[model samples]
Target: MEANSNIPSSHTLWSPHDTVKDAAESLGIALPDEAAKNLAMDVEYRIHEILETAVKFMRHSKRRLLMTSDINHALEMLNIEPLYGYDNTQQLNFKETLVGAGGQTLYYIDDKEMDLEKLINQPLPTVPRQTTFTAHWLAVEGVQPMIPQNPLPSEIKSIPPFARGATSSTLGNDITSSGLSSDVTMKDRDDQSRNKNTGLSQNASEVKPLVKHVLSKELKLYFDKVVEVLITTDPEKENLKYAALTSLKNDPGLHQLVPYFIQFVAEQITNQLRNIEILTTMLEVISALADNKTLFLDPYVHTLMPCILTLLLAKRIGPASKDNNSSEAEDSLKKQLAVREFAAILLDHIIKVYGSSYSTLKARVTRTLLRALLDYSKPVGTHYGTLLGLKNMGPEVIKLVVIGNLKIWYKQVIEDSNKTDYEINILLNTILDIFRHIKVEVDNAENTSDGAQSISEDVKLKLEERVGTKLAELILEQPDAIAIVRGIFFGEINI
Candidate 1:
């Protein structure tokens, strides 16, 4: 076996002069001299031959003493990575050979056939990406992994490659010598596949140690790479940015990244960012993040208020050119439409998640959102008209978002629609919700008891009659608004 295991020659790996020809073709230049031609032609083949020799050394050795000591000694003498590339290729092949051996072991013992590709490509659960943004501690070897004792700079650290652990020499040698999981998609499958090679199938419960090991070591590194890709100028990076945002939205543990997303929006808007594609993507991500109450309001609600208001106003104005032609206005319509759709979705999310806490803010936003819807006389601005169908269902849950800021709503709707029936109905519906809130307060304040009638019957009758009559007049004048107004007064509406 030893005699037959001679290293393959350069001639076996590469045809003479092929490398020089390929190099010349790639560079689009001719070799200047014979020495250059000879060096270029044979260099690649020489490296391949040396690696082949190292692979044969491993195959023939009985004790499997495939040592790197000789190569490292050679590297030190050479003062560079050897043109040989033997150590690198040896480390790779030793494992492949071991996996092949392990496949044989399984076949001999259990009479089961192995499909290398399937064994390698199986999917595993990924750690939620949001977890990386949190400043949580990790324990290793009964001690917490400490941050630097000396103060470090504020810049984010580049994650380092995984280092061999304390037990690596003993456990690692056997493991590294045996085989690799054929899957490159999995971060550390070879180490994970060890128990299975020993006849233990890794089920969800059994995979805990592998998960912990990878999460503690590799997850941070992977996330850092993702972040790097997301912020780059490469067009391909958009896919990564989308994935990162989606992961952030789904992750419960990593709430801190939510602010980073808000900051990304702030930065884009401040720069008068032209990448509308990214803006739309950011909007979708924000809408997803807003699904959680803590995510929607914490650290973001205040900043988001101003940003949303500005964007919505810009959208209302259409495009910036003063030409005032129908074509110009028509051309600008797409941006406004996009803004309206995004704003509706975002506002919907906020109302659902923050509920009453966001009521004061909602009132302010409602004026903006409801303007086009309420102003029936003025052709119902495109933004409001498109979203007017929203009004037909019921009042927005956060209708009282502005609470005492009734003037904003009045000015926007009344100024825009002096005689329109739709405008009148919108105002009536909103006023009804306020009245319902007032009634709730009054009822709660005076707990009814037969012995102690809370207030004079006359006073109660007057208040109810006044409120009911005003509501009736509004409803009679605009019957379409009746459902909303009644819904509000009876507290049947979500808001």
Candidate 2:
């Protein structure tokens, strides 16, 4: 068979026969031309293979520059002995040598040998510093801080001026003085020069805007996977749910996905109100996102608050079972209560975490709950939620909202006989819970005159009357009712 004229016998990447022959001569070996050519091709192929493996090592180390260790590791991986005594910090310099009448060229590494005696006397090199890390704010509120650790604006403008100008203004002003007509006067020349200089200054002042960072495909895939796992209901997928929550809670780059997560939670909560599992999961996702210290959720608090409030104040959450058994009813109620309780906890967390960041957050939450609570037409479940929501805001909120409107709310409840025993019990328990925090101070009547004790008794009666019959009766039933009433009216306890 004949070979094609266009194809070479071996890869051109291989070193020339003369260079291989020179290497063989240095070792006192006389190599044939065919052997030298074969050895050169083999050496080239081996070097290519080693480099391919070395690139893997570089990528694994998260480095761009291929290091000496990477090459050694690649060699080890290939079951070959690594090159020795090659200092990674030092660059190898090669010297060129011309040989024979043919003017053939050969390159050899210029490795200077050192005397053993002088090397042994040299002091040991200084130990390299241990790797350490220091953290600083890379950016705040979407703007990079001009810190010493960050690159300067000039350094960041690394793109060529021509590349930047190509994307900028299209209008070009050629202000060469030679282009001016011969008939132009001195005044015209001066004006043209001044305008040209002004145009140049204007062009110099213009700057190309920084390109906005976009989410990478890998990040988008990760986000979608997280959202899918979070909304999954299978019991076996709990690990996925946990992993998704952990990622949402701890990932630093989730700022871009904050609005998306918020919207997801809102949409799921709206669509899956009857599915307690989904509602709870969505609430959990929101809570996890809120817990992430790196995410700035203050901007989305308004959007998030309504979803949380809906879960807290929804009339129905878990589905009611068709079976009329007491156990099923109890189970349904329990699930509803659990969902509301979780929502209340989330609400409290959001308020504490972001109340100061958003100045109107607390007020806005309080107003929404108050409106629901005071509405006479609202369902009993909503009233229950409103009371619980106020309860979660702490004892001070309970006093301001619950205690202040107790009489009016009591009248409404008393007039409405349609309200169930369960609803009435929840409302009463909520009131008692608020009253429990009100500490009563008793006057030192035993040490004082009888006149002081009579006055204290009168003050207690007035408090009982003001609180109305039902609350007074509930308070009086307690062992320290008189003292409690006296404290409510005359004590230093602030609302």
Give each model's whole-structure lDDT: 0.46, 0.72
- Give the count of colliding residue pairs in each prediction: 6, 0
Clashes of 2: 0
Off by over 4 Å in 1: 1-238, 273-275, 292-299, 315-328, 356-495
User: What are the RMSDs of all candidates, in order?
Assistant: 27.5, 25.8
In candidate 2, how many Å is residue 278 off?
1.1
Candidate 2, 1-495: lDDT as tens digits: 353432335554665454687799999999876677788888888989999999999998899999888999999999999989878889888999998899988898998898999999999999999999998776676456999997686865885444444422211211111211134444565775577456564446546568555688977898789888888878999998998898888989887778778888878987888898898898889888888989888667767777888888776777865653467766787687788878888888988988787666677678778877787776566777787788777656766787778778887864564765665776787667556556354444422323233334455456556677777667656554544554455444321
TM-score of 1: 0.33
Local error of candidate 2 at 10, Å? 99
lDDT of 1 by residue, 1-495 (tens): 664344222333443344554567689877544545456446765555555565565565543554664444444454646545334343332122223644642222223469999988988778676744434455432344547542243321331112212332333321211111124424354555564355633442332224232243445565567457555677877787777767666666545355556776667654553455545555665666666444435435655654544443333334354543456554554565466557555655555555465445444445444443444433223424324324322334324332223444445545544434543554455455443433323233233333123334453343334334443344334323333333334453321
Single out the weakest 10-residue window by summed lDDT for candidate 1: 173-182
